[model samples]
Target: MIFRNLNWTKNGLNINGENLNHLRFADDLILFSEDARTLEIMLQQLSDESVKAGLTMNPTKTKIMTNSQQIAHNELIIVNSEQLEYVKEYIYLGQLISTDGSMNKEIERRITNT
Candidate 1:
């Protein structure tokens, strides 16, 4: 997608002072951003670009998660004028990620699942 024009998450693995954004695996895409506004912009841009490429984003299946402890309430993320679902925890690449940035739940899940 043509999402390079929009701002993205720059929180990990800085290469020469450049931050990396998101992780793509197969058909799944995970976008990351520290702020809700940036994420909102990115999501909107992605939706627009995907439409141009004959692809559509499923608002129902799309979810927004944050690892910020300061955020006590769920933030509304809109795409295509629809509000995306906000989840406190999400499983990505078989790893559980929580809004509080703790792996305790993930570990417990794995243990129970096993």
Candidate 2:
């Protein structure tokens, strides 16, 4: 999701499928999917979108985690040092709360979506 004042002039990434969720505020984009294959495809599409938008997805800053028990190391959240579990809130200053109270005013101010 986009944050701060960074300009995301490029077009946002668009993926098609059922039960897929995507959030884009500026350059910061977050997506979620239930199916494994769909998630994989979405990531691929994200890479393409990054290229097309002239935005670079920093490999070192990116993290991919799987929730399935069979999937090893399923706890990383890309571009963020904090664990996925810690991201239970996304505070948006002066805005309505969204999704499980993740939208905290302090958190939104701290969120630096480059």
Candidate 3:
């Protein structure tokens, strides 16, 4: 609900019908796809849209993590580029979403504790 000007599109993929969206963000842009191929398509679409809108997609700031295990706040667990078995985690927004499917229970508890 942050980027009120951006549009929303239907993502025609499902893994157990979880609550999901193709793209979600407020001031910054966060895009999601069902798979790697779909993610590629989405990225291309983003590039095209940006071009048409006179906006720019910062490749330096843009990051792609394929085969995502799960997405909580916005972070991702992505396999390392150099190592196949190595996985890395990142945080997006203010929540911790892990590839292992863990939620920020402690943060939620703290918020409610007050």
Candidate 4:
């Protein structure tokens, strides 16, 4: 609801330019972008909106994963003046998404867990 006025990411697959940039289920929010710059902008906007709504983002619980072909070792994304930790893979909605955009590890985990 806080991002109603914000611009979303476009996948370039639609003729009307309508694409999903983020997903909201309950209190969890997942934002996606093709580049770090755009992602950072989105994060900053989220942070600002959260503050305006009397909410705060937990930096420790925030994780960033990139699927870029060339990994950036020095890329830093800041939220509320603190840098978020970059992870090789992240679990969202019970699915593991890796930096390389592969689900092989996620499948293995699911099998092992089952």
Per-residue lDDT of candidate 1, residues 3-104 (tens digit): 665545554335678776677787577876667777788788878887788888898778887667654346677788898888988888889888778889
Q: Quick one: best TM-score, which candidate?
A: 4
lDDT of 2 by residue, 1-114 (tens): 212232322322334533335666655556565544454555555665666667666654444433345434443433322332322233333343344444465465548542
Error in Å for residue 15 of model 3: 7.2
| Residue 70 displacement in candidate 1 (angstroms) | 5.5
TM-scores of all predicted structures: 0.75, 0.41, 0.51, 0.79
Q: How accurate is candidate 1 locally (lDDT)?
A: 0.75
Question: lDDT tens digits, residues 1-114, model 4?
Answer: 577756664521233657657777876778777667777888888888888888888888888876675537478887778998888887877888887777789989999999
Model 3 lDDT per residue over 37-89, tens place:
45555566656666677876665456655444543324432322211122344
Write the number of the candidate with greater lDDT, choosing between 2 and 4: 4
Q: Which pairs clash in model 1?
A: none
**All candidates in order of lDDT, best leading:** 4, 1, 3, 2
Better model by lDDT: candidate 1 vs candidate 3: 1
Q: Distance from true position, residue 88, model 2, in Å?
A: 10
TM-score of candidate 1 on Cα atoms, chains taken together: 0.75
Q: Where does candidate 3 clash, by residue pair? A: none
Error of 3 at 16 (Å): 7.9
What is the Cα-based TM-score of model 3?
0.51
Task: Give per-residue lDDT, candidate 1, residue 1.
Answer: 44
Residue 48 in candidate 2 has what lDDT?
58
